[model samples]
Target: MDTAGFTNLLTRPGPYATVLADVSQDSDNAAHAKELRVRAACEELSAQGAPPDVVAEVSDRLAANVRLPAPAARVVVATPEGVAYDQVAVAEVPNQVATWDPLPDLGSWIAARDSSVSFVLVLVDHAGGEISLWDSGLPRPTSTTTVEGDELEHVQKVQDDVGWAAYRMQQTTDNVWRHNADKVAEEVTRLVRDHGHDLVLVGGDPHSVSRLRDVLADQPVEVVELESGQRAADGGEEALHDAIRSALMDRVVRQRTALVRRLEEAWGRGDRAATGVRDVADAFVTGRVETLLIDPDALAGRTLDPADHPGLTFGEAPVSGPVEAGEALVAAAVLTDAQVCVLPASVLGDAPVAALLRWA
Candidate 1:
């Protein structure tokens, strides 16, 4: 997910309705049941005063677009404008908790399934190989490409022409190998730029794996060579998944640790940081916040409009019910084109949220 994509989801004007559900079907009966359940759930939200138009739109869209999960999936739907559905298998999406709220509940689920970050899996051998763009929210590859080289083994083995035939065959093989490598490099680079993927895992034949990595070494994202992998449809995919998980997990850890250090530095500076909800909210209104770090656990604070300010306000009670603070800050961040990353409780210390400001 690029900044624009996430920004759209976060900043869409409310009242928003977000739902994550399992719509997997095993039989005709299961499929029918799932369909009815979806309609019923949408209707239930409508009954609870969700926008009639949005509900109608969601219903029609879900009816037309809903797909049975392979085994099971996490299907997320949002209102007004944005992605109506995002899903992946139980093994990939992991936890599935159905939810509907005025705000999109992607906070808890973004890193696990819906984040734009994805792994490019390349399994290459001498003859040919497969490259798959993998994202947790979708059960299969978003894009796939096959890398194949011209056959030269039999030509090399021919004895009639002696060394000459072997030499020519070797030349042709080299050409084919370079051509295939170039194709993989071009496609993978495009995916990294256009689709927001930032990591790649290459496995299979040792020579081929190293060559592919060298091809992508100039790309900014991580390009790792693994011990083994195959492009099988099932069962044989574990190696690739395991390698991807490990690499991405390392990235997540490094990112979180770096963010903590940055927060500490900003706080020490005093002027460029905001720790509590009130201060963070104020920072957002002033357009000072460049990055927001929030704990998904403490997202329920209410921040109401202050009389003097037009954009946003905090630390004031309202005569009427107030907007959820987390949602409000997210909206502000998106509107201001700032970044938001989930900061866990341990790293966040006592604050519900924090901001690293662009300026004092």
Candidate 2:
């Protein structure tokens, strides 16, 4: 996940109040449930010595998403100024955390965002396609568009004749199909490029799928040709939705695996790698980290004194006290434009944090 989103929280002064909680609007009493959750979070922040103004701001911000259904959890970080960083997280928060700390508890927020995937789903046929940009765990697409190709007769195969004249007719039909596919591919590419889409799912007509894959072969994003689905209304059929979700999850797994493999290879060479709290923190502070792999549980309760790292890039305010090590490291990573990937507990053995640095 890109840590740049934390610029607001990092640039402002803290004792920041970070709240991670369930904000799902699926139930009939969703408004009340959400209010209750917001109330609880606010009360906790108050108990943690957060200012009333900050607590009120956090409450209002958390409750503002009552109408957005599933991807039930949200993470909000607020300084006394107002809400700073707010984003919808993965489907659930098994354990909600509310804290007022020297630095925001960013590991939880990062973990939640890391669990989700963003991609473009193109349901195509020979004549056109429906393109929707989606994020896994969210109920509706962020954007939806339809790409229709030129109006041409006979955009499909016809085996009625075999003469030269017949071949000419078939060639025209093939051209129409390819032309339409190109139209859809162009739109898909634009959406992926503009949105920084992680994956592209192409489904529907097999020929159309093949053409789209061909056109998108050189793009940096991954293109997964789904085995099912067609152009339809807002949400595709249940089975199609399931297939897309599965593809997104599979991509997540593959990406995490690849990240771990890269770290392992770099570690084996004993270069471009930093492990344990102090080394990883130093790397982040110096802007040397390319990817910061954090095990939230491993780093829980750890602290980093600002005086120890005089050049910390978190905010303009001077050091007040020790900050949560995970939060401090993540803040530094964000300021330096590094990626943060949350690992499962203990995946890094006893090391609370590990990093693949830009240089040795």
Candidate 3:
């Protein structure tokens, strides 16, 4: 997951209250349900010894935030000063998480962000295409725009009448299709370039889909076509979303496999890699970690002393005592501008934490 978004949080004072509440407003009494969840999270924070001001801030933010349409979650990290970070994710939190600790409990937020996919959804036909940008961890697309092709006198193929006229008409139709698909492809390329999306989900008329795919073949992104995904049909959006979810999961698996393979190869080489919490921590402090690999279960009960590592101090606040190892590692990785990959324990073996270093 990209840690760029949380870099500002690292520079803020801690003793943070982290809350992950299911804020889905799809229920009959959504307001009341949300209120209950917010209240419960605040209560958890208070029970965990969070300052009252911070707890109230969290509650207010969670309550006042825009409601999402489907199963969603809101992640809030606050300090006595105020709410430092608050964002809603598309997916729901399986269990509400509220933590009051020396460092923000970012595991839930990170997991959600990592699992949620961001891409461009393009539904194209002979005329044009509707392009929507699905932001990472957001329930809906940030923006939806349409790309319309040039007006053509005739876009249909001709039959029987033989020879020059038929051939000319057929060529015109093919050209029209290519032209429209090219317009969509150009817009898609521009969107991906501007937004940094690595995936483009295209679905619509089969010929249009083929033309767009052909045009986008040279671009550096995965183009997936869903035959069932179309524009404004009965239950089309729901079916499209389902297909997208499956594609995202498959992409995640592939990414994790590739990352693990790279880590293993680097480990075998005995260079440019660090394994176990201690080595990973040292690499993080030195800003040598390019990618931080974590097994979430390995973080249980583990602690790290900020006083022992000067590099761990990001904000002006002094180190009071030990902090959760998971939180500290994530914070350090973000501070150092390194990518964090939470992996399964089976892949990591005995290593609680591992990293592909910037250098040996």
Candidate 4:
């Protein structure tokens, strides 16, 4: 779910197909068997009248995702005229029907690729810190950097000689923690500049996490302290994922709510909101749309002649469509680099598609 890679698939003209298959290997022949299954899926596309070249490329790409070593799952996306996007198993799910949709149904993919949303998770303690960059939406951290320092451990009680030693150890730990934070902040700034992650998550030693915020004060990113065990500790991934999952769930809904509010505000003022498919399509033609919103289940596979129906134009020629209305609007969203948001059926009310326009 690298943004650029996804944009290619989403914005392109169809006959694009998505194939999600179990590529897990159990035996010596497992890899070959997986290849055959994926290849067969591509053949099905060809049989369905997809371009021969596209099918061949798709097959090659799908095979590559599993390759010699087996994968847990595979998602293959191919467009006839554009580049193919193939990714190894990020999440384990059933072998969906080549998971084919007009455009690769990115909903699942986006949801599965947690790192795609752009965030930096820092796990820090007095001894060191770990920085995990979640920018490319890869199954693993796109990049990680660890900063190390003087060893520091807790002394539970302070009594006479033991108290003095404990206090000294604590002081050393504090200094090392402060130093580690500065170094971590420097690395974080570089990553933010290079990767553009907007959210910052911190977990680990509470004191380290607190010191981190002060050092990162000037960095332009939203930093949140998470309650969890550190990644370097046992069951780290699960703890990190649990916290991240909780954070993202709230974030996604808030984002959707904001988009809805934007749409409603524009409509209320009669400034530039396009409500319903017809108006939105017209907005696309005029290159007025800044955000494209749709109900994924509505108006699906519905086709209309540009000449006869309300046609959405992509701010260009072919001002109408015999193209499936849903697909056409998706293309328009991509063409204009507008944000594409799919809302649930109830949230969209009666509108199949809506647009927040760039201009009235």
- Steric overlap count per candidate: 2, 0, 1, 2
Per-candidate TM equals 0.74, 0.91, 0.89, 0.75
- Against the unseen true structure, what C-alpha lDDT does each candidate score? 0.64, 0.81, 0.82, 0.67
Local error of candidate 1 at 144, Å?
A: 1.1
- Candidate 3 residue 110 Cα shift, in angstroms, is 1.1
lDDT of 4 by residue, 211-329 (tens): 88888888888888887858465837787788887776666667778878887787789887877767777777778888777765576656545564344443322333365666566
Q: Candidate 2's residue-wise lDDT over 308-340, tens digit each?
A: 765666765345678788888887887788899
Q: For model 3, give the RMSD to the true fold.
A: 2.8
Model 2 TM-score? 0.91
Worst 10 residues of 3 by lDDT: 153-162
**Number of clashing residue pairs, candidate 4:** 2
Q: Is candidate 1 or candidate 2 better by lDDT?
A: 2
TM-score comparison, 2 vs 3, better candidate: 2
Q: Between the candidate structures 1 and 2, which one is better when assessed by TM-score? A: 2
Error of 4 at 22 (Å): 6.2
State the lDDT at 23 in candidate 4: 67
Model 2, position 40, has a per-residue lDDT of 90
Residue 79 lDDT, candidate 2, scale 0-100:
84
| Candidates ranked, most accurate by lDDT first | 3, 2, 4, 1
Candidate 1 wrong stretches, greater than 4 Å:
1-3, 6-14, 22-48, 51-116, 153-176, 231-235, 304-310, 313-321
Residue pairs in collision within model 3: 90-137
Query: Which portions of model 3 miss their true places by more than 4 Å?
Result: 28-36, 155-162, 232-239
